[model samples]
Target chain A: MNIKAVVGRNVRRYRELKGISQEELAFDADLHRTYVSGVERGVRNPTVLIVGKLANALGVAPCKLLEYKETS
Target chain B: MNIKAVVGRNVRRYRELKGISQEELAFDADLHRTYVSGVERGVRNPTVLIVGKLANALGVAPCKLLEYKETS
Candidate 1:
């Protein structure tokens, strides 16, 4: 799978795990709701600083956002 | 240490370990030399996609670029 896709999927999964809406997550992360949506949809390329912001909001290590699980 | 600083150190360490200069890494990673320099200086906020590119050039997991080592 593509790296962006992995990042998007992990972001979505972590967001859901936190039980927060996209708007809520965006607010917590100090980002636009549309940016959060774009990230979840794998259409946005988030910078490391942005990733740190989102990870801080999600209460996970920043590296968690880039974890990749390969599928056969 | 700050996240950007950690990232920059890791990138520089990995590049040096690979016996490549920043310019060579930038060339192999298809990034501008100045961009890599900024990253190494902890002044650039590179996107996740850009991290993937650098990691690919360095032949390591993308998360390797984000690893943190706490110094007391």
Candidate 2:
């Protein structure tokens, strides 16, 4: 799987686990809602600093956002 | 600690463990040597894709480069 996809999937999974909306996450992460939307959709290639912000808002390790089981 | 610093430290640690120099790693990762140096010094805010490349070059999970023990 693509690395961005892995990150997006993990972010969505964690956000759902927290029962928060993307808008809520964006607000907490101090980013635009559309930016957060793009990130969750794997369309945004965010810098590590942006990843750190999202991870902070999600209350998870930044590395956790990058984890995925390979299907190969 | 800064997220970039954590990644840099991990990159350096893994690179050293593999007994490779920055030039070797940069070549493997298809990045410039000076860019790799900047990354190791925590002076670069690389995207996740760049991290992926570095992780691939270092033969480790991308998440590993972002892991660090909290010291606060």
Candidate 3:
């Protein structure tokens, strides 16, 4: 799989695991809701800082988002 | 202490450990050497794809870049 796909998959997986909506996650991460949706769909290429924010909001290590590389 | 610094430090650390020059790593990752240097200096907020490419070139998981969060 592509890097974007891996990230999107993992983001979706983790986000769902946390039982939070995209909008809620966005609010927590201080990002736009559309941006979050774009990331989830593999259409956005977020910066490291953005990833860090999302991870902080999700209460996981930032590396968790990149963990998809191992499975795919 | 910031996300960019953490990534830059880890990238430089791993690159040094691998005994490769930034030019060589950039070539391996198919990115510009200056871009790699910028990333190493915490001046570049690279996208996930760039991080993945760099990690691939460094022969480590992309999460290695993010592992800095735990140590810092």
Candidate 4:
């Protein structure tokens, strides 16, 4: 799988788990809602700093956002 | 330790281990050198997609970038 796709999937999953909307997450992360949506859709490539902001907003370690279990 | 600091430290370590400069990694990752520098300095937080780009440029799994062994 593409790494971006994996990241997007994980971000979406985490957001849902946290019961937060993209707008809310983006607001908390000090980003645009559209940008957050693009990221969740795998259409935008985010940077390391952006990851930190999102992780902080989500109350998770940035590394936790990268965890994707290998599927057989 | 701050997560951003850990990320920056790890990024610098990996860049050195790969014998690549921040400029080289940024070019390969399709990012700005300044942006990469900021991330490496822990002055910026990266998003998940950015992590994907960096991991791809570094020829590593995105999750590998998140690995920080808990120092006792």
Model number with the top TM-score:
2
User: Quick one: ranking by TM-score, best first?
Assistant: 2, 1, 3, 4
| Runs of candidate 2 exceeding 4 Å displacement | B70-72
Candidate 3 global TM-score: 0.92
- How far out, in Å, is residue B61 in model 4? 2.6
Tens digit of per-residue lDDT, candidate 4, span B1-72: 666677777778888889999999999999999999988888877766677788788887777776667872
For model 2, which pairs clash? none
Flag regions of model 3 displaced more than 4 Å. A69-72, B69-72
Scoring the B chain of model 1 against the true B chain gives a TM-score of 0.94
lDDT of 4 at B25: 95
Q: In model 1 chain B, where is the ten-residue run with the lowest total lDDT?
A: B63-72
How would you encode candidate 4's per-residue C-alpha lDDT over A1-72 as one tens digit per residue?
766666677788889999999999999999999988988887877765677778889887777767777871
How close to the true structure is residue A24 of candidate 3, measured as C-alpha lDDT?
A: 96
Q: Write the per-residue lDDT of candidate 2 for residues B1-72, one digit (tens) a residue.
A: 889988888899899999999999999999999999999999999999999999999999999988877652
Residue B58 lDDT in candidate 1: 93
* TM per candidate, chain B: 0.94, 0.94, 0.92, 0.90
**Comparing 2 and 4 by DockQ, which wins?**
2
Question: Which 10 consecutive positions of candidate 2 chain B have the poorest summed lDDT?
Answer: B63-72
Q: Against the unseen true structure, what C-alpha lDDT does each candidate score?
A: 0.89, 0.92, 0.89, 0.80
Model 4 docking tier (incorrect/acceptable/medium/high): medium
Candidate 2 lDDT by residue in tens digits, A16-71: 99999999999999999999898889999988899999999999999999887776
- Candidate numbers sorted by lDDT from highest down: 2, 1, 3, 4
The fraction of reference A/B contacts recovered in model 1 reads: 0.74
* lDDT score at residue A57, model 3, on the 0-100 scale: 91
